[model samples]
Target: MASENVKLEPLGPNKTGPNRIQDDGIDDYDPHLHREVESPTTNAETLIHLLKGCLGTGILALPEAFKYSGMANGIVSTFLIGLLCTYCLHVLVRAQYVICKKLKVALLTYPESMKIACEIGPTCLRRFAPYAPAITNFFLIFYQLGICCVYIVFVGKNIKAVADEYTTNDISLTLYILMFFVPFVAIICIKNLKLLAPFSILANLITLVTFGVVGYYVCQNLPPFSSLPSFGTLFNYPLYFGTTLFSLQAVGVVIALENNMATPKQFRGAFGVLNIGMTLVTIIYVGMAMMGYWKYGDKIESSITLNFPPGDVLAKVIRIMYSIAIYISYGLQGYVPVQIIWSNYMAKSLDNSSRKSLYEYMLRIGCVVLTFLLAITVPLLGLFISLVGAFCLSALGIAFPAIIELCAYWPDRLGPGRWILWKDIGLIIVGIVGLCAGSYSCIYEIVRSLASGQT
Candidate 1:
């Protein structure tokens, strides 16, 4: 759908409207808060920003996800899941425009859209309208924090792998965690999006090169066809789903990215940045999953990066490259919660304080420490990634978007025989099923791993 064509009828006095929106047409969320800095992201910059945001440590784990679904199922499943995710993103963007048009507002954050959608939907959903924004923020906070923890584990595991080869004195993961903790804190403290953009660009370049190098190694010394399974056990599908979902979906930051665009109107077009970026991301992920599995088969480690030979200097360089890239990414992912918490609750109280800068820096540093401690405690990279994906992202990625679409169009545009209505319902069902199955599988694996002393 074209972004320009997403117009809706203006609402009457009965429906909730943004009567108190800022004169400049931006909503500062709370009356006490000052207007947010105007966004300057061009389409190209937004594209790069999103590409960096979506692809990360999770992409490296695709080979392991392939291990669950096998070659035959993995290819089809990855494509289907990727398509579903893209469509859900479309639904969310469209819903944002629809809600904006009806409410007579210029912009809406993801949580604000959620609240509006719920309030406008059928009477049954209206009761829960007040809680929608909070629920969305809760998921966004934990999801972003979970990603930070994954980055910590990713960096620690790779560094430990390299350190084990050269040094006889085995270094504990905790020490490695401490080693990177300070730098991570330093990175997240850079709060301005423009300042962080350069780092994200560098991170994306490193990831692209890392993908190319990874592909080169996989191309050489490929596994025999006989060694690869065409179809995997049914029980492993959920685990596969969780990892793929984690790797592909970036629902938590959808509105943040769009609202920050130089022209937010371009964000929902047929050839929009979201579609183009997600399309490229899917192709790269599918290629990595299929090729990595072809090279390593069932023998693939939890991360394909770990499968590289220890003594190869190039391999070590790639590991270090990826560690730096993922470390940079920690700041980008953490920025979501940082904005939510700091702006809404902390910023007002601290902004007027004489020690404002000190407290703000401390808050950022403390958040980094929180994620580090969790990463050090759990340390199971693959299992932890899947757990967060299933439990948190499933809702953000699938169920919530579908719900948003339904709520945005219900009883009027989607009354009867409307394909959009049925389509949304189907998507909701798919999302709910994935959420249940993936959650069960990930939790079970975590429990089993704990019992076996794997974590």
Candidate 2:
């Protein structure tokens, strides 16, 4: 195993120790200071990865939900949700960079990244601030897998639709699965994020092409779009906001990028770039979804393929490209969370005397099995994702950051609230409100949908 692997050279970040990361936990919970191998990533590279990973694939299919929700409500929901997500992304970035800076200064391991920012406790969460990154990582892998499966379905559908003219059946479902297996397997073996940088750049270009095609088509048919639906269509906003939360979810990406930074010191830079890019992408995304909905009306499906009329060659080609690009995007974006969950799972193996490689395989298999269970049992993928993400990831990524930061920054405000320090208390209240409003709306819709048997 050692010889088959190229020795992991010090890319940039220092190693915490060569003691083979205590996966099975023979070591104490105390932070390890030996420098860890810096993952092959830069602030700039992380920015690109975040954009391609978060914005590229989901934006294509999300308009389907908007169409279901109706135009007026759809656009409104998109903006409001976008605003909430923007805030969540901002807080997660600020919290992570703040925590990382303290960890580096203390010469602590990344797992203990929160120790300097918060008081330690017996639980791994308090000791490690588990929910923030660790819990979010779990759901992120699930989100990646869900989006990947959606991509695969879209790829097969688009190809079959177009290719059917050329051959009786140019691509079969079996062939599609078999075809993706090689590339998917190839991606898994690529070592780390930096090696895949070129692919990330190409994927972003593909997204731009998708943007060009979708934007041009919608703008060209503006009159037709407005006439399709009007103000009475606003009722579907709740569910639309609920389901499409998938698009705004990037807190896990924030944490992973921070972790993988070659120089943790550069988190401020990476985060700055990440926020700027996301702002621009959000504007483009809302526009695309709105225009796509307005142009196609309620006839759209979750993958954008349905909106492209059967006879238009350009639309057909766009569908095919969008599907394939999303497939690659999901697979690539999925890898980080996969590594993250695996890392935490392996932190057990690395930290313990009983550490074995088999745990790695088990973790992967476990996730696949769980995804299958949820997908089969749950009627709506969007609702299922939002449920898990809101209760878990959103809490960890958004709420926890605000809580931890407030606690760390303003200790006096931690006392019994109403009578306590007003200034800091107000900030906490606003954070809680945003968290509750955003999370409540999502969770409420999921529950309501499930009750009505819609999800």
Best by lDDT: 1
TM-score of 2: 0.67
lDDT per model, in order?
A: 0.80, 0.53
Badly placed stretches (over 4 Å) of model 1 are 1-42, 262-266, 349-356
| Per-residue lDDT of candidate 2, residues 257-312 (tens digit) | 65566654554543566556666667767777887777666665555655566678
RMSD in angstroms, all models? Answer: 5.6, 8.3
Over 1-455, each residue of candidate 1 has an lDDT whose tens digit, in order, gives 01111222233333353332112324333311211335468899889878877778888998899989988889899899888888888889787767675665555677777787887776787788889978987888898899999999999999988888989997888788789987998889887768876776777788889988898889997767677888888888889988999999988556667766767667778898988988899998999888888998877877798998889998899999889988888887787787777776687887669998888888898889899888987888888888788878788989889888888886567756877778877887878888798889888888788688884
Cα lDDT of candidate 2 equals 0.53
For every model in order, what is the number of clashing pairs? 0, 24
